[model samples]
Target: MKKTPSIIAAALVLGAAPAFAGSATPAAPEPVIEQAAPVPFSSPDWTGFYGGAQLGYANIDTSAGGDDDGFIGGLTAGYDFDLGQWVVGGGLDYDFADISIAGGAADLESVFRAKLRGGYKIGNGLLYATGGYALADTNTLGSDDGYFIGAGYEYLINQSFSVGGEVLYHEFDNYNSSGVDVDATTVQVRGTFRF
Candidate 1:
């Protein structure tokens, strides 16, 4: 009886072996890979020293009701600090004017200014406002001290170059020790090189 049972178990094992032998089990699949999108670029760095030149039109008004209009040119130098989206700086500039007022009897000679500027970064450009003290010389009015306020827009051409436009108003009280007042409004275009 024991020999019969042993023979039966052996036959069952031999029969089950061939069914699993011919077919191999499949392997686990690899995980799917996904790529990420790139990020966009932001504004350029504006922390540096800069020097430039400017040319523009000047329109002068006097308390005597005279209007002086002509060309103006200048040089500028400044340092800027970029605090993320805001920029602040101070600059010194000198301008020579060819403006004639009082029917060519009085002409503007030169202007020297020290100014402070604050701006916001907008795309590839900067929009700014400036205020400063001005010292002006005239052919007949001599030299007078004054103040100026202005606004401008500047665009970066590259890492080293920029271009801009500005509008400013200047006022002098009791000019040339005379009872007369002088005011000048200017529209200018500027180019700058950064270092």
Candidate 2:
């Protein structure tokens, strides 16, 4: 009977000991965490090329006599150097137009021109200037030849296209067979393509 009592006590002690032992503290609530996605890598860059056409109005003011205005059209080809905020390049341009002087009565035939240019880019726009030689048909009184200097600004619409405006001054010797030196100024708006 004493043995039975001792065994029962031992059983009770073992049960109570298991109850006093702590439960596993619930594993710290699984850390409640979120993770972000990895970012993608980008490729290295290279310089590109472009080309386009231009159409604009030209106004010519002659020192000897009068003023003339007409439509001009041409093509442009250029290269961009990818020089950070600025692009440097050379280009060729030509245009043809019919002009009149003195009360729209005295007419000059087609005036043809070609020029070489260099420019720098500012944001989406470009600030530039050019100087070149020019050839033209006969004036109302006679024929002439000269050099021109001009400044302009252009706004780029995309990687391949832009439009702008310019003003140029021209000086001719022996203008119109009069042995007189003459000066002319022109203002024009133009478009261009980059290549």
Which is the leading candidate under lDDT? 1
Poorest 10 consecutive residues by lDDT, candidate 1: 19-28
What's the CA error at residue 33 for candidate 2, in Å?
Answer: 12
Please list the residue runs of candidate 2 whose C-alpha ends up more than 4 Å from where it truly belongs after superposition.
1-51, 78-82, 102-106, 112-114, 139-143, 176-182
What TM-score do all the candidates reach, one by one? 0.81, 0.59
Displacement of residue 69 (Cα, Å) in model 2 is 3.4
- lDDT at position 25, candidate 2: 68
lDDT of 2 by residue, 63-116 (tens): 456667777555555554556555455555555566665446444454445565
lDDT of 1 by residue, 1-195 (tens): 879988999998898887867756665789888887787778998999999999999999888777878999999889989999999999998999868865676789899999999999998899999999999998987889999999999899987999999999999988978888889898999999999
Candidate 2 whole-model C-alpha lDDT, 0 to 1: 0.62
Deviation from native of the Cα of residue 28 in model 2, angstroms: 8.9
